[model samples]
Target: MAHHFTAYEVEELLPELKASLGLRRFIDEEGNEVQKVPLGPEPLMRMYITMVRARILDEWLLRLQRVGKVALHAPNVGQEAAAAGSAMALREEDWLFPSYRELAAYIARGMNEEEILDRAMANIDDPLRGSEFVVYGHRKYNIVPAPVPVGSQVPLAVGAAMAAKILGHSVVTMAIFGDGATSRADFHAGLNFAGVFRAPVVFVIQNNAWAISMPSRRQTAAKTFALKGVAYGVPGVRVDGNDVIAVYTTASEAVERARAGEGPTLLEAVTYRLGPHTTADDPDRYRPREEAKAMEKFDPIRRLGKYLKARGIISEKEEREIWSEWGERIERIVKRCYEKPPLPPSVVLENVYSEPTWNLEEQMRELEESLEVMKELGIGVE
Candidate 1:
């Protein structure tokens, strides 16, 4: 029993759907401060360092994949500022529901390079234990494992925030997804529920202008992703995703608002994806190389470095030194991760059940026997 909307009702909703918010930007492409930055010298430098490491890590991930060291990766090449700025805005206790391309967010949340590499390399000690997906979840960091399905984590974040509200806790949850996810059912459900319940959560849409090979224009007819919040009775904010200061400023305000019981806000970070969707993708087929070249001027890492130089927080030489230093450290970490042992075949059933059934026990024994036989044959079964 589906009901059709009246023409009058559709007309009434059109005005609310109009794009109203302007993109919030603090710095220009040249790294000139166009607006007063909210962060001071020390914090700014720290963020810049994190952004650099994220870029370097992304570079290594691409290289490692090429050399067969890494199985697969969703590169965070061009969207460092969007991940770093918004992630750094959260408190230690706040929960982060991230996407596969949140390398910077993971780093900003204090996930060291070694830990990230371990997961990426699928080493024996990998937290997810060589799971099919390259998702991240860390109890110490209060971060949820990213779902492989697009936009699936949105409702989880909303539910967590609702629980916090009912418990009288000040925990605000933030979920980050890409532009393509805005069209998903989970995203809509999460936003509507958060709005109706006044849940303490923030929904960040990293509108990197593409959903894999699908351009954003094909994903939605809305003038802006932020405007999609209007129908759900949520406030929307548009920010420059390439500007770290701008993203941090807006995310901080949204976090504070959620902590104050003001409910969820839909934040749209407008930027470009300057790389392929994954290591298996080749952007050149669908995305114009000329367009990618043009986006280089808005490079987040270089833009931040220039801004820091202009502020006298770091010199040109210091910026180069920062890159060189982090690059060497990342090389060492990658070497260590490469040297790690592969997971044992028996670990597959370690956490599958509380008590193994008789059939399961028999299967485990068979597997053990097979491994022993292989070891006797010198087939590297151990």
Candidate 2:
């Protein structure tokens, strides 16, 4: 049976029908500051540098992947501002739950390029011990590693926020996910729980227009991803993800609200993915080449650079120097990491248990025996 909506129900249940709303933006595509936001020169410079560094690292990772040096990469070519801007808004004590494409967020939190390269290469220095590919989690930075399943981190972030609230800790948790993740059960579950308990969490959706081969249009029937929060009784915010200043301002507000013991805010960052989803993807098969080219005008790094240049914060000469020096440094790091040896196969079995189980010990012995046989036959285990 279908239920009909009355006039009051229509107005209350469907607010999108009342009036059209636009995404918040601080800068134009031409890099002109259109709206002023309360961000200083220093952090603006830092965000720009972090975006550039992420772009360079993305390029090198793709190159390394093409040559079979790196295993895989989830590039953040055009979505740098969404990650860097929001990440900069968080306090040091706050926790970050990241999606796979948050390279700028990792860099913003002080993860160095060398460690990033080491993880990409799955070398001996990789903190994950080569168990995962390009999934980053750092204890010092209070970042939780991304899981392969989409939207799974949402509940985790909500749980952590509730725990903090109960313990009377001043910590807030932010979870970053993509538009595609909204379709998952975890997303709905987390948002509902957060709304009821008023969890101190900020949910950021980087709506980059594509979820692998699926476009954003097909992802949902809602006018905007942010509005999804309204159903859960959480306030919704939409920002221009390409404009660094706008993203930072909006995220900072949301973070402060959550830290003040208010309910979570659902933030939708409208942006585009200018490259393939990952090195394994071929975006050309789904999206047009012209579309990606068209998005270059709204490039986060380009827009931020122009804004900084106009204010005399960064000169053209300094911009060139930053890119060139960072590019060279990344190349050097890649070369050194590529030369490093991979961990032995046996190492995987070492960390699974405090004391080796009998079955695991038997398997280890069998693996050793097989390695000895291969060595005797002049066959490399690798």
Candidate 3:
């Protein structure tokens, strides 16, 4: 009996290729051109600044959480490349659907430091109404407010992509999520819907090895996170997440593919979470400290730094100056956030609804009355 293989069967039987194709490189850690991804001087400098700023913001916010100034914080310390690289790939008019831990994405998309710090400080002038809500919008930059709920932004990204398609626009939407989100139903649903509708959305999963305490192995039995896209009939790409050029190149291709009306693509960036999941978590409890230390050898910022230095885009003196300047900027922002006053009692009711419902109106009245009573008692609202 002669058996003929179908196209799908043939694809399944084909040998897997290394994930280095379509990547740009300038230098390797050993100061050699070992299949590097190249970046020009200006863009290289910009990437360095953006990555530093993201790290600084994460550190400051974690401090705020420790001091009880902020209720919660999710650190994106080690996942900067995944956020910054994909964000830099977007066109100015393109939209971004960000998960909670996307400080880099927001900053890269032109979110002001004050706006971000305000939200963290929960001040009266905070753009997103002092964290009473999650979405922080910068209408001019086309960056959507980040959603706090896990995997919720996936459908929103799909919807935005569909809208862009219907309007005959070339805009692409990138939905950023963590590996933990892949197990959720929304992940599957969003991918399936996007694939079927041929939506112009790129699903980027930062596979940082753990979903809080749970390891990636327990997250799924699948050999690779990228393979999940195969079930939805979209191209799935797994890239070295710590390789800034590789991450940028992969995301750039996916963005272009979506814009050309080809369809959605799933990019799994395999990176590591160096710090604890949040200020509230203790990584030592679940993962080994040695493993985290081992991952530091592949730090994206260091790798890019080496690449840029090797290409003469940046020198050791310039790197020191940049670090000093970033330190000053971070200190200034942190101080500003700490000095700002808390939100007023009235602000809590402002953005509760587009138009206040009767129930909301009643609640607002009650809140105001309670404040008035507190004032009578000579007590000030914090």
Candidate 4:
């Protein structure tokens, strides 16, 4: 008998053991029941609202990027449920270490819309002040700064988890990233150390099945990203990332385990990236539009809406009203962001040091004199 099987043969024989983790769902895409509801009415309503908010914001921001109102954006279009679900599962004071594409998670963590839009506009009121681009970090809420390189935040999350253990804090650090990041050295080191020390951290791999234009097959040959945890002696599980309730339940379980000193859990969220890798990427260059369009049928937001409607927890009229409310809110914040002036050039000198160093002082002096010349020339640069 032939030992090796082709991709098609593998799919035919063990369809669930593909490059991606098998989809787990409480409710199928057709609105038919698969298992018990993962959340009650109240919690379901809350998660639904957040998912819709994220979806609306993602679409609006992508439009802004296309029109040049925003500098760059990584759309989390089909991936909202995973971020929103996992983020809501976290308790207060627990640290969130996110990759560059986790805008939905930030929103669920109570990140103010004005600040996010301000940063997107790169305005004076932006907390990062251009030092960090996009929705990178918010130390106030304990969201660690997301480094540009994939999986860079993994080690940082592990370090925080280590610190939490030493300090006797019960906080579990959650590091969320794309599946591509799993191939990085930091991902291995982070999970390995977290396993060795039994650090309280949950590794949430938002497996969108694509790393830029590269498919997940090019990234790994393993049956599932979840199994990658076994090498580090950490237990892992796969969850239906599009099912917000499932993601929340899985994440909450892992977080609780970590808090109880049971060590880390590798949570591979099987989801899809419905847009380009970033504003700079062109999905059309590689993937087919028809394939992406086919994914629309399994959209997380649409799935949740169907569930809500089936349960009578939401009506079409009520849904439309909710959307209107969000639209007004986004419009008000965006207007404020646009009306705000850019930060004064000198503000750059403030955050770099405890006190101004000689080089910085000299640079500031030169800038001031240049600004004086510009002022005399009636040139505006602020």
Top lDDT prediction, candidate number? 2
Which order, best to worst by TM-score? 2, 1, 3, 4
Report, for all candidates in order, the number of backbone clashes. Answer: 0, 0, 8, 0
Q: Is candidate 1 or candidate 4 better by lDDT?
A: 1
lDDT of 1 by residue, 1-382 (tens): 8989999978875544543267888889899998988789987987899999999999998888888777888988889999999999899989999999999999999999988888887888788787755677788898898998889999999999999999999899999999989889999999999999999999989999888899999989878899989889888888999999988888999999999998998889988888889888889889899998999889998898888889899988888899999999999989989999988787766666788878778989999998888888888752
Rank by lDDT, highest first.
Answer: 2, 1, 4, 3
Q: Report residue 15 deviation for candidate 2 (angstroms).
A: 10
lDDT of each: 0.89, 0.89, 0.81, 0.84
| Model 4 lDDT per residue over 1-382, tens place | 8687788865553422332255566877765668888677898888888877777777778888878878889888999989988888888799999998887898888886786787777788878886756556788878876888889889899999999999999898999999999999999999999999999999999999789999998888888898788768787788888888788888898899999999998888989999999999999999999989998887888888888888898998987888889888887877778788877788768779888899999999999999989999999884
> Cα deviation of 160 in candidate 3 (Å)?
0.6
| Candidate 4 weakest lDDT stretch, 10 residues | 13-22
Best by TM-score: 2
Q: In candidate 2, what residue range of length 10 has the lowest lDDT sum?
A: 13-22
lDDT of 2 by residue, 168-254 (tens): 999999999999999999999999999999999999999999999999988899999998898898888888999988888888989
Better of 3 and 4 by lDDT: 4
Off by over 4 Å in 1: 1-20, 354-359, 373-382
Return the number of clashes found in candidate 3. 8
lDDT for predicted candidate 3 compared with the true structure: 0.81
